[model samples]
Target chain A: MSSLEELAQRVAEGDLEAFGGIYESLLDPLYRYFYWNLSSREEAEDLTEEAFLRCLLHIGRFDARKASFRSWAFRIAHNLLVDHIRRGKGLRKEELDANREADEPPLGETVEEEAEKRALRQALEELPSSQRQVLVMKYFSGMSNAEVARALGKSEGAVNALRHRALRKLGTILESRGWR
Target chain B: MSGRKSKEIKAALAEDLLRRVESPKAPQRLQVYGLQRILARAAYETRTVERRWFRNPALWRRAVVLPLTALLLLAAGTSGVYAASMDAPPGSALYGCKIFFERARVALTVSRSSDARLEMEFCERRLRELQGLPESGEYRAWERWSREYRRNLEGVDSLLDALPAEESAGLAARFQAQLEEHHALMEGLLKITPAPYLPYLQQASRECMERLQRLRHRHGMEEEERGQPRGPREEEGTTPVGDTGSEVQDGAEESGPCFPSPSYPQAELEDLAPYGEDTAPSGMAWTSDAEDNWGSSPKESNGVMGEGSGHEGKGSANHYWK
Candidate 1:
């Protein structure tokens, strides 16, 4: 069996050491995934922990044939993100306001470049959740289209279409800002 | 630039935009701590199965059927004509009868204690074990046990459902009375505790077996008994054998045994008890710099190789906005 499968087997068998190892290995990636979506360091950390707890709880149901351990984990993380967003318990408007305030540049840079980046972030925030998700997974986390599709429970074709539409909208936003 | 080049440029821009969007890094301690908390939770959750097992002793008794059957067959070989006759066809009604009696005997032995909590715990444990069996045509007893077990579970579900949403505060009392009724009904089935009571358990088992045998004999085939026809109202009465309304009402009035609270406190986030020390990191970390920044450093991004890099590559950039 592959290493991940072995880890999963150990996890199912209630091996804490194996679980810890798996947690250590996957924590960074999962934290990044949550952080990108939630955009708050604190919320991302909490959600990442929540996701791992959920994974531990549901380890018995993990079917390796359907998806890799990483994919399954990300799916859990994605669901946790959705739950966090829905609850609005931690970091919603506060995060956006914080980001807007922090966008103030310390070093000298061209106004056009700063404007473009700010516009891009705004455009990203404005895109439909599906489109935004595709962009986040594809570009931010560096997952392949296939992986993103599997994580999102969508067809690869659908992911590609989403990416295309998201990029087009982003281009339009940038063009309107006279940054293109 | 050609349309293709424009597309390439757009892709680069998207990549750069993403590169600029920093991914948050959790403190190493928090990751470790969270994992420990989860492991602790898992350990605690494992006890739920044990609790379920303790709640039903019939399941445990039924689990021993195969072993008891083997022992009985072995004993019969050296015994008299009656003993010889006791060894009916393996899947025959008579065989099921013997197993049922053996189960009653075992249940009686285990459930001798007057402690309702202990009895309930044993019954629940047995029930959990029975529910774990794979349903198959060959395991006829198992099938019957599964049906009864499911009915019992539904009864419990319904009983809990009948309660008001805020009844969690009074759950102990409710569970206690429900447990008492289950214990009483099971005690009625198995009377092996007091020295004089052994015969009663044996008699009850024998009666149940005889009834089952007559039912099977009337059908004339094992398959017919396996798929016994049900009356239209059969499902309505399928509540657990012991769940009378008085028992439920009594449970509501008398507080049952106090169980540990299910909800973990948010303040105890780092305390992964019983499993090990809480290795999880608190969100705050002491850094070498004079300034206390709660956010950890976003690991250095090695831009996707061969991908057109869009952002100005800057080392040591903090990922968090703050």
Candidate 2:
């Protein structure tokens, strides 16, 4: 069994210590996925924390045959993202991301590299929500097509199509912006 | 050339997107606080369920077996039943579950603005639940829900006060508008909601209206200082900007964050308190119930008061919390 599955089994069987293991594993991916989707890191963290709260509360209902704990947790995050957008945080949040950038530049990155990343964030924000979710899961969260599909409740083929479409549209946005 | 550009952009996009969320300390911080709270909550939930499970065989079927079947069914279908929680009212067996999710949300949300938003949502939800209570049969429920309603507004008040003047402006604008609507809604609810709820209803409506009035007064003062045009109300030349404050502002509470904000100073609230009454006027009064509703009494609520901790015994908004 996968580590997440093992952890879920442990948690389900009442070893609360496993909560830390599973939480550490999922935190980075889930936090990154949410941080990119929302404008403020604080808001992202709140939603991320909320998603885990739900996961812990509902761990018993989890079925490994249906989805991995990672994807199931991602599904919870996805629903929250949808609810957030529905509450009018969607398009309006993009307006805020126009100003905020990465917390710290990684080692040896250039000034222009930072600007390009900023432009790319703006571009990513413009992509449709489904496409963005697929990309964030596949690339940022390092989930497989099947895992992304399971998280979003879409077929793997549909997930692939979204990734393709997201990439095509992202390229168009970057080309038009010409941020060299 | 276009194809090459597309490839480079896509590659850069993927790489840069992955690099953006790199906060190292935040997760550890979250882990420290999140685990303890989640476990404490888990323990509390287990106890509540166990306590009830042993106490009532009838509730056992209702709480355990039925929910187990529902959880199985929901494992595939709508996951919302558990997440948003069943709309279990105050005394329902699943009500503890409902409150557990709310506490987790509030406990997990450390950001001031996020907390304000969540409190706004909760206060609004509490009001809606109260409205739908159908009759005066549930006085305890009414008291519990209304107390939460008051606590939420106080939470919002404290959060907004804590925000820097610049940061609070936009959010306060939105909140002032919302509180206005809530004030109106509560006024309407007071008239229609049944009799047994009169004192609580009267207190709620008055509190709602007074809070709206104070925020509006502060908001107006800020606009004036910024040298912007007066609000539509003042522009209409009808409401004497501080008419309410001038007549009825509470004297002892001026030191509270509620009144002396942005443009107005604490002395100004004192100046406005023409009457000798030490108590706040209407919605401005923070009662013994000012402490929030997360199973914490007013005294215990001060534990997380953070910056507002100084105002503890001084009858700042914390005075209203019980």
Interface RMSD of each: 3.4, 3.8
How high is the DockQ of candidate 1?
0.22
**Model-by-model DockQ, in order:** 0.22, 0.12
In candidate 1, how many Å is residue B11 off? 4.4
Q: Residues B233-253, candidate 1, lDDT per residue (tens digit)?
A: 322332122322211121211
Worst 10 residues of 1 chain B by lDDT: B272-281
The prediction achieving the highest DockQ against the true structure is 1
* Tens digits of lDDT, candidate 2, A1-180: 349988989999999999888888888888878877877667787888888877887899999988888889999999998999899875466467453754555567778666766677788888988998898888778799999999999999999888877877776677678743
Give the per-residue lDDT of model 1 (tens digit) for A1-180.
247667987989977678877787778777767655665566767777788888888888999889877778878888877877778753355567686565444355567656654566667767777788788777766678887888899999999988888887776666566654
A-chain TM-score of every model? 0.79, 0.90
lDDT of 2: 0.66
lDDT of 2 by residue, B1-322 (tens): 9887767676566545545533323455576787677677777766676667656688788878898988888775545545545577754556567666776788898788888788888877877776776343544555566566777788888888998898788778887777766655655554445433433555555455556666766877898999999867556543321222222233322233233122223332233221112222222332223223324433443323334433222334233333
Predict model 1's lDDT versus the native. Answer: 0.51
